[model samples]
Target: MNQKPVNLFNTFQLGNLHLPHRVIMAPMTRSRTAQPGDIPTDLMAKYYAQRASAGLIITEATQISQQGKGYSFTPGIHTPKHIDGWRKVTKAVHQAGGRIFLQLWHVGRMSHESFHANGQPVAPSAIQPDARVWIADGNSAGQMLDCPTPRELAINEIKAIINDFRQGAANAIAAGFDGVEIHGANGYLIDQFLRRTSNKRTDIYGGDIPNRVRFLEEVVETVVAEVGKERTGIRLAPYITQRGMNDPEAIDAILYAARKLDRMGIAYIHLVEADWDDAPVIPESFRRDLRDSFSGAIIVAGNYTAAKGEAIIDADLADLVAYGRWFLANPDLPYRLQHDLELNEMKERATLFGGDAEGYTDYPDCQEKAS
Candidate 1:
């Protein structure tokens, strides 16, 4: 067996910040927040800064508007209070010497009317997906329910939504984020437009691949303008096998987008290469295409181990590898990697979502320390 290099400890650059390693803490939705709105609490700050050992931290998807919401207790970046809350979070992470980025998101048709502030869900087209979203009631805890048909966004509405993302990027900077990441992945709003199955419109926002990607292109341009191009990144799930989200020959679309983003000088592109089981296998051709297209960093995620991550970096497939479940359970993940320590088991899925601090902050680090 080949021994891994201790120089994994070498520093790297992510936009304006220097990282201590190449292990990234991928953004994950814990769905733990206060009621009425998704506000970051002091405990949430500690939870993030505790995991600061990561080379870089990409925050959980934060909705840019009320209509951008999908699940209950998910954070947002639309209001002053939200920015203030995130201000505390970014300060804590920076104090711990961690560089973080805020992921700007809009769920679009993935959300139900009840989740929207005006009780009206919005999307590219007025289509309802055969999906369910979680809703929180003051009396009852929460429940997974059906989604409703969304209001088709007019051309003007589409422009406004782009502006909203620009504002979200500004808010992220005000909150002290090192950068802003555009969430164009999963089955969310941006992905909804990218995939032909979800986006069925004759307008400029939909039709062929370029038209379908118009929303994402505009968003990238808008955000890059708000925050410098060097400080902007994008998360795209161009080949997700889960949730029935996929486009024919998805790699072509991804490469096209990556090349386009490269011309814009974006910081990095995060590709979620996971199957329904959350296992990852990047096709050789796809990996090469990504490496050739994007001159910047490429971060791959979904069930990647320390050894596997090192293999990817060695293969020149990606600059960094993000660990989802592993980082969640082990706050000192980078230390564990350096010392070749065993990782803690993942928390029970039954208690993963919509909790205060039970599974949120209760996960033990590599060693026990005084609170």
Candidate 2:
């Protein structure tokens, strides 16, 4: 007799937290933080609280330091004000009975000069990525600006950034976050160090696969030291080739890092597959290899529908499924998906980035719409 297949709504034990279901709310940067200081606002708190039914809500990429910032109006975790601001968000989420994780990020070369005081973004090497980051205009509207050639970071700067990750983890705990997810994907600073296309250094942190993965290992070790391995997760994008991130050896390097992360006993490894309409499919062999390499939980995100999510979980390829755009529009995403209810369509593309409650908190749930 065959065993029952795993359902999408099945309860999952992810590290120390016991999730109610397997539907995770993936991280999406909405550039809605308070200006001048990049602090979380009451509106952001309400927005997160509205979607508290998710198994886990991984917050939008939050900069760990001022230098980690790339896009405008994105929140930071480096300052007293930021911590206080995030406390409000955490309190609201907890009151609403939700678990949240802050995604620690540093954009590296995927940044413009305007965000830096010296007008130079820092990266593992001086390579320039063909990427554009959103910078808000005078009217608070955002524009995608091209990134410039970034300055290569010194050995000391790399160490400092690792410490920044450690501090960011500590600050997230102080702000009452359940955990932290290191943004090691999508051509960010950590991703830059992992790929040969971006990192062209001769130091110990460059060259072979082991050297390339050293920076990521160090960052993870430091964060785990700060807030235990159980509360730490990481995101990796092996199939993503956009924004000058098409590294041929990226898969091997990520797998090598996954082995190390498995030994380190981190909570989960979130893989971001390419999501474009015509994006290449991730090979099944890679998935099996990844599962073999990492014994902990695995979360997969990239335009996954409810059926597709259940299929992956049933196949034992991934433990949890994260919905990004779907969760953005449907605050009660899990309920709707579980009950086969109609989802609220996303409205006003302009409001997706740096706007107010029009597109953020005003989306009605199934009950609200019925009433």
Candidate 3:
């Protein structure tokens, strides 16, 4: 008995987001925002509009506030000017008949003092990651400076940051985004608190799994209060060990969070797989556990080829699959996949970040490729 082939072009309804297909575009940092205030530009709008074929396009991780910023040139949702800038982006995407979600981001310990009001980056504890973040410089891809030790956030400061996230979500709505996706993954602020490796706090925000997940719970609750749960989603990485974050119990802790989020009725949970080669494989048992715990749509993104994604969706492991680098190079990715067309390889490694139209907006579509 032969089963019919699973189709990546199948339609999926994610919360209030009506999609044309299941080929979602995962968020990637291009570091090309307009300078002076880290605002989204017409160039950025064009870049997103070009990829309107995606079922859902999650914008690059955007700083929720000035203190939330970690990298160079990433957009923000903290001010009137920022909202105006994002308005252009959302307008562009909507006009192209696409739905886009702005990912609210805060770097936490994966930051440098230069980005802070005071000369200290705040985190769950005084510890820091052994990694670097991109900063503005004359260098093509910007300069990667080592992260410094951070100051532990006071309980008052933690409460303020939660308000920042809530305001950010409200601003995303004002900016005309279809919704907001909380950046709780990739060893960023939320991930910093979720794991025990970086968070050494003795306060209510750390210690046991329930305590560690407290900040996440508050942030989500606030954001969902600002924008309905159906319009809010979160990204999480249960197996990633980057940025000196190796949480021994991350898998279980995240599954617990998943159950909680399911009970909250959020839009979806994007599972970010480690992007590096030879990354840890999230076992099938874990996937099954996650599926059972979270009743909402599950979006998995990693080294997914079309066939691999189709297989995962067919198995009912995930409702949708996201593509990052491949979607960047191939703007008409869904069309290519639907017609079995060859994809364009990445333009140039040098043009991936902090570049101009060459790599950002010049990726040819299938029609152009045919010519």
TM-score of each: 0.94, 0.98, 0.97
Clashing pairs in 2: none
Least accurate 10 contiguous residues by lDDT in model 3: 1-10
lDDT of 2 at 40: 99
Q: How many clashes does each candidate structure show, in the order listed?
A: 0, 0, 0
CA lDDT for candidate 1:
0.83
| Number of backbone clashes in candidate 2 | 0
Candidate 2, TM-score vs. the true structure?
A: 0.98
Model 3 Cα lDDT, one tens digit per residue, 1-371: 13322567788889987788899999999988777888889999999999998999999999999888888888888999999999999999999999999999999988877888777888999897988988767554677899999999999999999999999999999999999999999899999999999998888999999999999999999999999999999999999997888989898789989989988999999999986778999889999999899999999999798888889988889999999999999999888777667789897677877878988899899888779
Error of 2 at 286 (Å): 0.3
Tell me the lDDT of candidate 3.
0.90
Candidate 2 C-alpha lDDT tens digits along 60-116: 999999899999999999999999999999999999999999999999988889989
Give the Cα lDDT of each candidate.
Answer: 0.83, 0.94, 0.90
Cα deviation in Å at residue 57, candidate 2?
Answer: 0.5
Q: Pick the candidate with the highest TM-score.
A: 2
Model 1 Cα displacement at 114 (Å)? 0.7
The reply for model 3, stretches above 4 Å from the true place, is: 1-5, 138-141
